[model samples]
Target chain A: MSATIHFTIDGVEVTGKAGQTILQAASEAGIYIPRLCAHKDLTPHGSCRVCTVMVNGRPQAACTQPVSDGAIVENETAEIKELRRNLVEMLFVEGNHYCMFCEKSGNCELQALAYRLGIQAPRYPYFFPQRALDATHPDIFIDHNRCILCGRCVRASKELDGKNVFQFIGRGAHKRVGFNAPDGLGHTDAAVSDRFVSICPVGAILKKRVGYAIPVGQRLFDKRPIGSEIEARRAKGK
Target chain B: MSTKPKVATTSLAGCFGCHMSLLDIDDRILKLIELVDFNKSPINDIKKFTDRCLVGIIEGGCSNEENVHVLQDFRKHCDVIIALGDCATMGGLPAMRNHVPLKECLEEAYLKGPTVYNPGGKVPGDAELPLILDKVYPCQEVVKVDLFLPGCPPPADTIWQALVALLNNKPLELPYELIKYD
Candidate 1:
């Protein structure tokens, strides 16, 4: 039998199984390492480095880094906070993320993270690259302008739904999420019941006819900050 | 004569929703007047800054030459600058046009739009009109902002708290509910 691995995240002692990553350990200990691509239901991609934490004086993506016994992990620090702010800012400018008009205004993970990181405005120049929107699908739509390419939807479509319907197309700056169907989302076998509909962390992929169903001040992260649920669960551990 | 703090406010490239939200302070507006005096603001409809103000609140992003000019004037005349809304803090709804080419945006609005009154294909290129910028820029990009309060139109309570903190010479601490992007 494998022994439990113990680690300290920001000086908080945490324990996890031998195979669990540092993020998983710290998360069980009630410390929320900010991440975009590391979802509970899917395998860690480590594509977004928002969850980078200092381990043994070196920076490492917590989602992918396995927890070792007595590992000293510094997840919250002034330096890390500043780094996250810049990353979030870059994400904001790299796309046409006009949160004021987006249906996912309050519910978006990116937007919530921006608020969490205290990013009033992006310091970088707005790229404003022209993108497209695909509303061909009758039930769902994809607005490419809002896509951050975290690969959550792509991973969910393939690993969970067992239908490799989505894949990343192109390379470098032109790279974007594309479906397997030659005709677009409309022709794809993706259904509303698939995990593909709920895996998107932004307004990029959305279910049609359900925008603003919850209304402002009633949505997730409206009053309660993101990760509060995890933090609450952590408190209950005490 | 009262020794209340003097304040100025302006809106550029933004809907007056922020200004409306400011008035949304409701009955507290009377309390606000008792706390601070308005100088150059749409609320008072003051065309010019009567004198140098202590705090200047900008409620929109810079989308044209005129916006830059006004922002610069505020920077020169005001002691502290506060970006007051999502538009001012980060180019809000107007920044959506940033993706489209400026020429195309103009053409869509003027020459080849769904609703255009002109019989002849003509665009508004009057020399007197303020020249539009290629993309909308948040107030911080154009000016040194001392503070930022972000929201589509920050809740009236948030604005009031910020103003009170500024007047009282204390650090502005906002509650979670007061902080929202929409």
Candidate 2:
């Protein structure tokens, strides 16, 4: 009942489950792949493009690519690092992100990934997309500008709460999250107890009243990069 | 009154946070009051008049019959209507119940096994309770909205800048920091 697939990653031969993705296999084998939108509980949304790896001489998102027998995978190529850097730069310009003021500063996955890739400054012109704030609920907030369109909040709303409250509207740069109804937070029946706010990997959706309460030194994942943090958590069996 | 456009604000089904955000402008509300004629608001006297108003701001979603009627009335009276909160823009939090069937929601909230006075009584079929829309809709679905100022209620500075843009007839632009989700 066991099926295995062999592939070469960074010139090293590795074996994984037949249905495993390259990223999944790489992670199990202690290979670091930079990603923002990929989470353990949620489905993969390849919006960030930071996990792209060269497969048989072509670059593709490692999170979506399945590991095949005898396939050649390169995770540490200069071209891939450059591509990841460019992807991170695009993400920075597509939204408004002031890391100094952000509550997620030290613990942010995007910020950690950027530091890992050594992005000094974004080359693209900032789009400064017009986004709305939804502080209607007393506990949480939805800031459209910090959103990278990763659909984590949307998925959280649907999967955890059983409510498809948030959805993407429009196309391209005009794309933004919308409610299932026009009613404000007080009027709609959304429960305040849902964990969607905590699950959001980025600052797009946030806990309203809890910001700055933990101070700078004590926040979780504050002292290390996300990759290392993941490694640490794994070591602890978390 | 001055020749400037008269603006009215009201809340329907939402928490009054959006209105609070408008007032949170600190002393800036004084400046805004000087620019536009404040006709009706939660902080001011509630009066009904036939005078044509230039802008009407409604914060909240239409969850019941009265909420719908109020939105329609605002549409009839004002030249522009702005949905100012997440509930107004995209059913913010309340629309989360759209996933459940209306009957199931009623059972969970009222009926179930609870021994309330109406435990044995049939659910009221009266027309007074507003018919719940099958799906939560943004303000644009119920009526034409001139502009959308999305945010939990948006920051006070963003609101001030938007008002200034409206007064000067300039395109409203939000800074990247202001629009970000965090």
Candidate 3:
């Protein structure tokens, strides 16, 4: 039998099975910790730092850090929120995220998080960096303009689809996602049905010829906040 | 001799679509008119500032000398400046050229584009034209922006709520539906 761990997040008691990370525990307990790179199924990459939470008075990546019995977790404090906001803002300026015309505007997790965080505009200057677009694939395309380097595609392609189709190249501001081929994504064994194709949190990876099929008002995250679903879990638990 | 607070507005590298959305407040404009007076706006065709404005509504980023001059002028004359729409907040569609060299852009537009048929095969460099900047800059980057309302045009309701809150001296906490980036 798996042991259950008990922890308090923001003074609310929560329980989780042993070997679960703080994020997984908090999520099951209906506590929403803002995150960008940590998907439910994929292993935590901890690149975005949007899910940084205070564990026993020290900061740690909740998605990567394991939960401990009687551990004190602080997720929604003012200091942590401000830090998360800065991280999100930097992500905005680092890339040329033209959200206004983007196909993933309403449904994008990054864009929705910005709204949830009350980011009317980024505090930093827009970098307006020059990025590339790879459209060699017949069914899929990669627009580097909107990528946040969350590493979702890299992890999903490797772990879920069991394919080495996506990988990261470069360093620092020059870093970008690269496909597994000398020529392009088309040359790689990447298929439209691959998990990597639909796992991107932004418009970085998208299927061709299916843009803007959903209208603005009817789209996901249009009327509600991004973590509303997770937060909704609170009511169900009670 | 108007007693209401005066407001001014302009579009730099923008389409004036934000201004149209402002008017999309529909009949709430009657409420707006009762609260504030138009000082210098394309709406009233008041070409130049006649009074010190309580608020300056600026749309679009600074893409050229004229845009910079107008924005600096606004900073000097207005008490509060609101950067409205994606262009003013974060260099919208016009900023797509930020990555490309200016020479290439001019060449493509005037000399080498598919639709271009320049008889002289020359880029226009008239002295009357406003000098283009190296890159587009958001309104806040150039000057102090008191507030930012983002979106393609910020939806008329969002603009109305923001303006109303500002005029009434209330804290502007936008609702979920009113604060979309697109």
Candidate 4:
């Protein structure tokens, strides 16, 4: 068997077993690549486009792209930073994201990502899409406006709970989440205990009746950026 | 082209963010427009059409009389009526104030509070606005809904995948990563 392959990240070489995504190698070597869509427990989706890197002079999503021997990856670059800023701008314009008043204001992934990327104002015209809030369920409140569509909750429904209750509908900009049957969440097959709510990455899908329950300073991931949290978790092998 | 479905969308009561989010599919909007006939969205003008569409999406909550009528019309016209966004599915942010009484809201917003034309007149018995329901409710509370897409609004890619699944008659399956809110 051949030995592990070594790759260079930000001019520092890192070695890892074959078939690891660039994010894995970067995290292993204590290099931080910002990401919004990549989760340790769920399958990686390059939807947010925040974890992009310059690999051998090409822009690629570190979460989805795998590493190979002798490959050189640039985790930080001016062009990559600009691209991330644009991606964050698109996400901001694509929905009615008013983070200032949101309960998840300081703890939000989108907000954190914006801070990391230094986004001052949404450059694009706001889509100002009209979204809804679902509080019929006794345990969860779904806020459609803030959703970035990372699809973590959808995956949790399918994988952990084995209930195909939540789903996406329509195409393109007209797309949105929906239940399998004609009935709303109350009438659908999903239960309150389903893991979908816990896995949601934004305030869009929330735990019903639990807003502000966690004190301002006590919320997890509120103080530290996701990059640091990921590094810490990796350090602990979690 | 003949086999593709015709889809229409509408919103009521709550903000129109869901419809706008749908339009946020960006370049994919052109691709979707190519695949279906978008007949009666707020963004488009399709007059004198009723009950002939394949898919009908109604965003926002049914808080007023007009909302009720619109939902009824969608139910009558489309083969499937999807309650898109949280408001459509469960009475969103507007419903947050559901704990308070409607008269109290009116008094604060219109009569007792700030006034452009302090309609010093007594609260009209027959305001054009529909009477508020006792408790805020989702679209399915008033009419039949074919599907419910949760999220504050579901992610764009998830929405795309769902639509593709519907178009292809395949089971809609989103990766677990799409569902997390944290």
Q: A99-148 in candidate 1: lDDT tens per residue?
A: 77788888999988887876767778778788999888999999999999
TM-score of chain B of each: 0.96, 0.85, 0.98, 0.86
What lDDT does each candidate get? 0.88, 0.72, 0.92, 0.73
Q: What docking tier does model 1 reach?
A: medium
DockQ of each two-chain model: 0.70, 0.01, 0.94, 0.02
Off by over 4 Å in 3: none
Ranking under lDDT, best-scoring first?
3, 1, 4, 2
TM-score of chain A of each: 0.97, 0.89, 0.98, 0.89
Q: TM-score, B chain, candidate 4?
A: 0.86
Best by TM-score: 3
lDDT of 2 by residue, B1-182 (tens): 47877888888767888888888899988888888987666767665634677788888777766778778888988887878866676555565555567687677666674655674657666787777655455566687888766566666776777778877779877553343111
Model 1 lDDT, full chain set: 0.88
lDDT of 3 by residue, A1-238 (tens): 8898888999999998888999999888888999999999899998999999999999999999998999999999999999999999999999988998898889998998999999999999888888889999999999999999999999999999999998899998889999899788999999999998888999999999999999889988898888888888987989
Off by over 4 Å in 4: A1-3, A232-238, B1-182
The TM-score measured for candidate 2 stands at 0.54
Quick one: best lDDT, which candidate? 3
- Which CAPRI category fits model 3? high
Candidate 1 lDDT score at position A22: 85
